[model samples]
Target: MDEAGLIERTKNPATRESLRRDLEGMGIGAGDVVLVHCSLRSLGWVSGGPVAVIQALLDAVGIAGTIAMPAHSAGLTDPANWGQPPVPPAWIEIIRSSMPAYEPATTPTSNMGAVAEIFRTWPKARRSAHPATSMTAWGRQEDEITARHDLGDPLGPTSPSGALYRSNAKILLIGVGFNRCTALHLAEHIRWPDRPSVREGAPILVDGERQWVEFEVPQIMDDDEFLPVGDAALASGVAISGNVALAPCIIAGMPQLVDFAVDHWRAAKHPATPR
Candidate 1:
């Protein structure tokens, strides 16, 4: 079928029903903890956009389960960059005003875009990250863990979003591909800790006050670009066979209980490689 036709099919109620069933078949039920990686555009429109997706996911898991998503915002001038080149004042204000404000708690950190704003409004949530990458979670909060190590760049590499991948942490990634996965870096740190100590201390401007923060972050290899990709076989392989398979599953009129986990590698660009 045509691309448009495929998108329409996946957005239909039939597709939603199938997705629900598929989720259940995959053992995503009550008491399970899942971390979702998503592109709202890829899912198309349901009765409610992201809100509906969150609700549907919650329902499938019932009251005892937990759902998580990544919510990150980058502030180039964040205290860590105090000595760096001055940033555009107006852009900094825009980011500051737009970022969601949450009462710090012991649960997961809340820092993704609109999703962060939505979850932050809920009580009993916390915000955590190394520097640039931020995520929100509920149930078995890791506030203490992140707070102890929230350091480095306020933007770019050292953002505070890397806390989601703590050692032996059980997480579920959804919708988005592996390349976008932010938690896998922690696994890399676990694998290698003595490599130039890339993690550093920085300052964050909060409530008109400069707050110093520290974090452990991955170093950029000579060929590295984009989000850091971990080589852990368990967390670093492609789940989707190709765009062809992903397109149909995302666009099909019904959902099937297929194993859809994947890790997208951020392979280095090599001019010598055959095109």
Candidate 2:
């Protein structure tokens, strides 16, 4: 919606303080680690836009807490998989050879939205090393959460998803639905350990030098595929729903959510098996 429409719907602008209150009401509290996915527009007109939204999250989490967001650089992926605006087959090799290496300090997030893009550059934020599926985090546990990101298992046990799961973090969805949840990808990995594999390449720093590297990773599924599992979570009360400003929101424990998705998908895959 346009700014004018957002302003009209918002009634009162969402300032950092107000947003923090809403977040706390939704169960975000001090010392809690959270993986957030948000759309600034979905919150209606904010007093400080994405900045305010992020600050409020920080305020709710406090100094003892941590906040993390997907800083995925999908553009760094193999050009051969480019479908939104596919490049000519002949140009793929040229693009691969010339593409700039993924630099966590400068690489911009693709389609992750304004809030995440801002969080990626937030002061003291630590980003994972994965060239494509890196996650950025801030606050107390930032280092521990972003320390290791396995190239072959970008969302699996060695990635930030695993760290967050181990930490029992919360997944906060603002102005977005289950389809935007990245934590669910971890469930996919668990449910289909032998899922199909695909070759992916990207320019990344190796021994402090830029080089094009290739690796085999489990084929990533479309985000929409998580919708059914997410819906099921809400239906089963695994996730709590509320609102921040005019935007709909959901908060759930990351481990619970992932475990639920694994079971949900398993049941779907094996209809006769009791959940």
TM-score (all chains, Cα) for each model: 0.55, 0.96
- In model 1, the worst 10-residue window by lDDT is 250-259
Q: Which stretches of candidate 2 lie over 4 Å from their true place?
A: 269-275
Whole-model lDDT per candidate: 0.41, 0.90
lDDT by residue for model 2 (1-275), tens: 78888887877888999999999999999999999999999988899899999999999999999999999999998999888999999999999999999999999999999999999999889999898999999999999899999889899988899999999999999989988999988988888788788888889999998898999989766887777788889999999899988889999999999999888877775421111
The TM-score leader among the candidates is 2
Tell me, by lDDT, which candidate is best. Answer: 2
Per-residue lDDT tens digits for candidate 1, residues 37-70, read: 5554445444454555565656666666555555
Model 1 alpha-carbon drift over 4 Å, by segment: 1-19, 76-117, 129-131, 140-149, 152-170, 198-209, 212-275
